[model samples]
Target chain A: MAVRNRLTGERTHVPSAVGRRSRVASGPHDRHHEIIDAALELFATIGYSGTTMAQIGDRLGMRGPSLYKHIASKQELLVEIVTGMMDELLRRQRAALAEGGDVRQRLSSIVAVHVQYHAEHRYEAFVGHREIDSLEEPHRSHILDLRREYESRFRELVQEGRGLDLFRTSSDRWSSYAILDMGIGVSAWYNPSGSVTPDELAATYAELALRMLGAERGD
Target chain B: MAVRNRLTGERTHVPSAVGRRSRVASGPHDRHHEIIDAALELFATIGYSGTTMAQIGDRLGMRGPSLYKHIASKQELLVEIVTGMMDELLRRQRAALAEGGDVRQRLSSIVAVHVQYHAEHRYEAFVGHREIDSLEEPHRSHILDLRREYESRFRELVQEGRGLDLFRTSSDRWSSYAILDMGIGVSAWYNPSGSVTPDELAATYAELALRMLGAERGD
Candidate 1:
């Protein structure tokens, strides 16, 4: 069966292996990454449900058949985008924790990094927050588990801070939620081009997190 | 022009005033309010772009033509839902401020009420936050102005608190954003059926907000 390319309107019998390999041979980078980027841009802008495969193809100057050669489905793109973001976040957070500070310093570092990530990578953050419900099945459960693990870092920091008498919190769980939520909210409005730089916003949020946890001023 | 009712299998020449009046005669309430409620639920659950007038009519056991009698269009429903929420929030916040206390007490009352509103009216909050971008023209600007006016309340409190030496904040602007964002986040995750009651959540956040401002514990 002949398939008409959505972008160029050219007829292709199918997504040929030669066609896929030839596209990458002409460029140093793989088409898979490009496809994901286009999908992410569309998903973040028009929303997951509002976007279509044809639009993603149109964005990339690729036909529908060729686009499928790189991605299994739109849902796959969402899964890739969300899961990729979570993995990177977990990796960065672990590195921040490993650099090691006292509880106050450690919490401040993590909060700063969290705020910075949300501000710098606002599109990814927006999609992850908005399209979590759009994720399907095992990917949905897996991403949620990863998120819970990420949140546990904050919870543990608060618990350790409280134990050391450095942080005064009425409830450890709620305090952690408040800190994380405030940072997450940054993505909704933070502009890198604005007066406040990402680093500056991160530092401001870090101080706010410490205050919310009731850390002593002298400490 | 004849139109088919999406809900009930009937033909209506047009939205009849007598038909519209008869529906309300059976009850003491207006269909306009009920239509808004159904639209709110659909907008919050599916999304503004994803929801349809037919689906809203189906939710209310009314037909499309009759539904049109109560609302001008889907955009009108959105404008009402979002503007109504902002108006109600402004009213409640003004009342909270009017029942004034010291800076700490006033801020606490406002934060508590903010959290409570988000927790209890989660759907309205969700729609307002998610669908703000979907708003059109004059309504979009109108709602945003109302939001700015509402946010000014928080900024003013922080400014007042700082002036009186009751609150210590690194940046008055950042501190207010943190407090408001944290409370707004509650709408995304708060569960009325959960072990934590709305009042409990509000009180916890209020304390957090106070601490964030660096209010003295003794006060």
Candidate 2:
């Protein structure tokens, strides 16, 4: 059974005709994205270690062997989820920061972007936060490196604010972590159907972040 | 192999003689506490679902069956770790709030106690946060009930502050969760051996919490 990539021409296992319906409909790339979406849901529900490749296939109505055609391995699925989410976070964070204003405005923008990401990417955020320890080898270190890079952005922001006397606290790593960590908490329990919209939550968080950083209100 | 609980006088699983030694050391109650402690370490390292009763027993220098004399099943161990930590958190939070003066002081006190609890019971906190989905039936709901109650304290504090015009934001449950969630973040990444002590972290978090609440600096 030759499960081949239509585009890459890479062969591993044989996907059924139903699984390989790329000549029409959504195309191969869309199917690949769907496979990842299915895997993300499973990872959030059952965790990375507990989820099997077959389960991911089952979720997509495909055979377990056929999933190999789209993705290399379950580990790859996790790497994709963790790294992909980190990349998105970094992108959003950079864009938010690039909007560029005073320290208070910049910090508020950062908070808004963060909470928005957590709300929109709840499953990805969950897998990213909870499954770091499940990763082995290069993946673990790579993800940690990305995380450190992201964390440093927050710390640097706080430091810049401190230098400008626009923010308060000890202006240390601990203070930065406190603010950033609170943003991360949104992924754990933010209910989309709840009373608050993502914008509302983000607004409130921006206010909280400002207060936390000791930004002078009404400035 | 007759393993009788000398305290409860109940026979379940028979542990080896090496496992039955209380002659020269801590009693059965202490052994029970130790089992939970060892399990907490394993949970933090490998997660709850990945950890086995035998692994927990081995960590405590006892056989799996013998460990049962002190503790019960893995589910029970998880239950003990999560509930015990919640019980402790509730106690400490209540104590801290009891010593409060005004809304600012109360909120600050809450944040300090929360950060302190996260730092002190990191393993327990980690397991509690990450392993909630794995708990079955009554246990999951029970733990969640306790969590909701704990969360409501913060919400109530925020509400009280808002009533007095001391706090900003919408004064909703979401706002309270933002503050509480950041405190929960401490358990995920707070390093005890780092330059920041628990007191220092708590102090910073308390100040941040106040700022988040829109408290005036001089107040």
Candidate 3:
């Protein structure tokens, strides 16, 4: 079977029989995932710069040295958290766009997706925003490309909406930035313990996003 | 003579002779400012965690150890950069509000001051946002309090506007957060070599802030 990712155009081919085993989850792999989750919490709270391998391992009840056997380094975890979210965001955004609605419907879906992703992965989003400069080499450029691509999706939506005369703005690029920045800010302040649920916040932001583009209220 | 800081509400007594002569500045003080300017650039580029005192010193003309004579520690520089900005922003925001206009006019002025401050002090603003968690206890709480006060100014404006029927939003607090976040983001991406000036960008944001509140266009 051959499959192509709709957004990134990444393709993978898997023999039907070989692909049937569900990628063979193992103890090591499961532990790796746990380590990444722990790492995300530490990195988000203390910052990637301020966090250390020992602290990440301690959070998982493992020794610092043993963590090296499971994960390469703190940088590896940083790469995983940052890249995973961008890729997932691109996936969800593409899926939303594929639903195929009018500009307003699509815009609402996009806003919802943006807010939901941020709320769901607050730590990853926080680290991804604040720690970009900490990333070295090709990884840095790769993530930056993904971010640009993610943001460009909204810009394209604005451009198409403007073309249809459904949206109004003096500058498409700046307006698009303004819209994205507002939703993006949710990740920074969103808290599970807070009164507002992700769904409620997303809904509120969707309405506000429409208003930002000059859409009438209750329309 | 006596003096009071309008932004911070600090009171001090000043002997006219004691305060006289020195707005011209001194070598040590000037060097300290230069070091801060240098720190801002390095911290923004390298990520505060990755940047070292040696690197900061390298950015200036001094050797790493020699740099200690000018600035106490990297943490000292961080504190100076972050708090100086919070103090300055509060001052500017208070100044704008002091102008005293209609609700819409006051909101516009607040937005303008926010964007303009962020743009002019891009590196400081970037560090302030990204490095908060890197700070230790008392400093961290102090800065957070200052940020709270800064944001409360916008919240008060939103509340007053909502009271006047000039601003419309379900949650004044969240909407105020959204408005401030949008302008705070300008610091991250605003480029001097870019097409627009800070004043122009602030005007655009001021209008956008009004739109996000569901205000009538050109009203």
Q: What is the C-alpha lDDT of each candidate?
A: 0.86, 0.82, 0.83
lDDT of 2 by residue, A1-219 (tens): 665556576655664556444556765547678889999999998898778888988887777888887778888888889999999999998999999988778878888888888887889998998999888789999989988998888888888888978776775577778777878888878788887788777888887787777776653
Shift of residue A31 alpha carbon in model 3, Å: 1.0
- Compose the digit string of candidate 1's lDDT tens values, residues B158-185: 9999998988888888889889889898
TM-score to native of every candidate shown: 0.82, 0.85, 0.86
What pairs collide in candidate 2?
A3-A13, A3-A14
Interface RMSD of each: 1.4, 1.3, 1.1
Clashing pairs in 1: none
The CAPRI class of candidate 3 is acceptable
Clashing pairs in 3: none
Winner on DockQ between 1 and 2 is: 2
Best by DockQ: 2
